[model samples]
Target: MRVLVTGHRGYIGSIVTPLLRAAGHDVVGLDSGLFALCLLGPAPENPPEFDVDLRDVTEAHLQGIDAVIHLAALSNDPLGSLAPQITHDINHHASVRLAHLAKNAGVRRFLYASTCSVYGSAGADLVREDAPLRPLTPYAESKVRVEDDVAAIADSGFSPVFLRNATAFGFSPCLRADIVLNNLVGRAVLTGKVRVLSDGTPWRPLVHVQDIAAAFTYALTAPTDKIHCAAYNVGTEANNMTVEQIAGAAADAVPGSTVLVTGDTGPDPRSYRVDFSAIRSAFDGYDPQWSVADGAAELYENYTRWGLTEYLFSERFTRLNHLEKLLAAGVLDASLRFQLIGAGCE
Candidate 1:
């Protein structure tokens, strides 16, 4: 399989691209290089790439590509809320457009990186893939839109599979400290505290980055009948944990670290447990290996080994802060498009 992975330089993409290559698939990349400098460690091995933004991807970029693992977007709730229209433009409109282009260009497989957050405010019930989606934020709303629009275009030739991944955590070369587990670990390592601002009550489904990469790799070659237009929630049910539990795990991983629930952000409405049985049964021999404690430990080790700092953790590694900084510095325009001189603005 020859795969074209969008956001191949991103936190998840950096891990996914290499995993695809190791699985004997020829991998190419398409990224705007916005987060190219947000590296926590040594850079990953390069693949044949189109240095193009997701919105600017042309037919030429899709030419000769067998499949597309779409993972690029303005990810996270804060970023999406900051500019809802831009989020819709890129995450929803551009994503559906890419699907149409891929189908027209004869790309067989389209594995979209959807999120479990679409089952927003489902309370304690274990929401499955067929559950009614109640997206609480612009980011989750955009994902819901993409899944609906893209799945509508599925056909005999073009297979579109929606992998609704849980809140991703774990260390990547292109590290992200924005997500739950990573953020907790980083705070514990830097400040010796695992702080939760939302009363630590929201339920979150968490998955390690490597597990997510493996799930996608398997879906790439999964039988057409099984994966065609199917939606599967990635991650294990065992990993569905509350914010308090996650913080405790992080605190355990970092010696002398204490868990603190400030309750400053108030009660969060974005709470839901997800049922991952659909994906587990569909993908034979596939099960998420890392637990919250293990992932927390892994993150703590990596953050310490890589010399994580308060400034880097708070700003550069957090996606919302990083992009806002870019916009303020004029490196990215108001639309989040690159405006840097000689940076190949399209």
Candidate 2:
């Protein structure tokens, strides 16, 4: 299989790209290099990375490719909130156009990386894939819209698979200290404490980066009839946890981590957890082996020896954050800014 992965140098893509290669598929990656994202560490190695925008992709750009794993976008809520219009442009409009173009170009299969955040306020610990979607943020909303666009490609006999991934916790080759688990580990190592910024009760379905990679790899090989226009929530149902629950779990795994309770604060709209029954059913019991605890421990152990601790702690590191860059650029409004400021924009 000749696979094309966008954002291939990103934290998730870094893990997914290697998995695709190991499975014997010839893969090419398209990325902008967004050099600023290297604040956490060095770049993840990937050749044939296009210095292009997803909004500007052409059929010529995709020449010789058999399929596309669309991962490029202004990822994260703060980043999407940066310029709501730009978010729609890149995340939705361009994405829809890409699928249409790919389908027209005879690409065999297209895999879209969606988010569990689309099921906002599921009001339950385990929200299934077919559950009503209640998107809470521009980022989540954009994902919801694109899923429809990708699904539409099925009319043309193109196989489009959607993976609504869980809250990824493990460190990536393209390291991001912006995620909850990595952020917790980074804060504990840097400031000796990790905080749950909100009331710390938000439910989040968690998964390891490797597990997500495994899910993508599984989708690549699954029979076309099984995955076309299908949306699967990639995670283990038992792994659903709360914000403070994850912070507490990290405290248990990291030797020096002291989980801090900063008092009940504001309400975060990003509080819903997700269900993974669809993915499990799709893969027929591809149970994830790595848990959030395992990922937290790995991040901590690596931070202990590697300079990653300093890398994440540095003020300069903020400049490399895509989400932070969006805020500094005033692409986001004041209200969204206030909420994400404490999230490390996490």
Candidate 3:
């Protein structure tokens, strides 16, 4: 399998690309290099890459690609809220356009990296892939729109599998410190305190980044009949936990660290516990190996080994902060397209 992975320099993509290649697939990466300077540690040597944005992709880019794993987007809620229209333009419109081009260019497998945030505030019920999507932010809404548009174009000739991934947390070369678990662990490792922002009551399903890479690998080679035009919630049911639970896990991972629940009590409506039985039943070899404890321990070890500092906690590893810095520095315009001066548009 010759795979084309978009956003190959991102936090998850950085891990997934190597995993795909280790699985014996010939991989080519496509990234606009927005976060090229935001690397946390050493960068992985990637395969042949195209310095192209998803919106600019044509059928020529997908000419010899057997599978397309779409991961490029305005990743989080804060980044999406920074410019909502640009989020829609890049995450929704560009993604659907890329899918259309891939299908037309004879790509058989299209693995969309969807999010579990689409099931917003599913109160005590266990949300599944068939549940109604109640997106709460521009980021989650964009994912829903892309999933629908791409699934509508699915056919026997083109198999599109939607992996509705849970909140990803783990170590990657392109590490991120903004997500809940990572933020908590990073804060603990840096300041000896784990801080919870939203009262630590919201529920979130979490998955390790390596497990996510494995899920994509499974989807790329699974039987077309089993995965064609289907969506799977990617995570184990046991990993669905509350923010306080995750904070405790982080605290336990770091020695002499304390958990601080700043009782803000603000209303966060993005709480959901996902049921991942569908994916377990759909794919035979699919099993998430990392627990929250395992992820927290891994982050602790890596942060210690890499010498945790204030710099790592700053814009260098945080996505929204890095993008804002780039915008302020005139490297990226308001629309997130790179300025014509440095490295030309990529």
lDDT of each: 0.91, 0.76, 0.89
Q: Best candidate, TM-score-wise?
A: 1
Better of 2 and 3 by TM-score: 3
Q: Cα lDDT of model 1 overall?
A: 0.91
> How does residue 308 of candidate 3 score in lDDT?
68
TM per candidate comes to 0.98, 0.89, 0.97
Tell me how far candidate 3 lies from the true structure as C-alpha RMSD in angstroms.
1.7
Residue pairs in candidate 3 whose N, alpha carbon or C atoms collide under 3 angstroms: none
Query: Candidate 3: misplaced stretches above 4 Å?
Result: 340-346
Overall local distance difference test of candidate 3: 0.89
> Per-residue lDDT tens digits of candidate 1, residues 210-296?
999999988987889987999999999999999999999999999999999999999999999999999988888788999999999
**Candidate 2 segments exceeding 4 Å error:** 35-43, 309-346
Best model per lDDT? 1
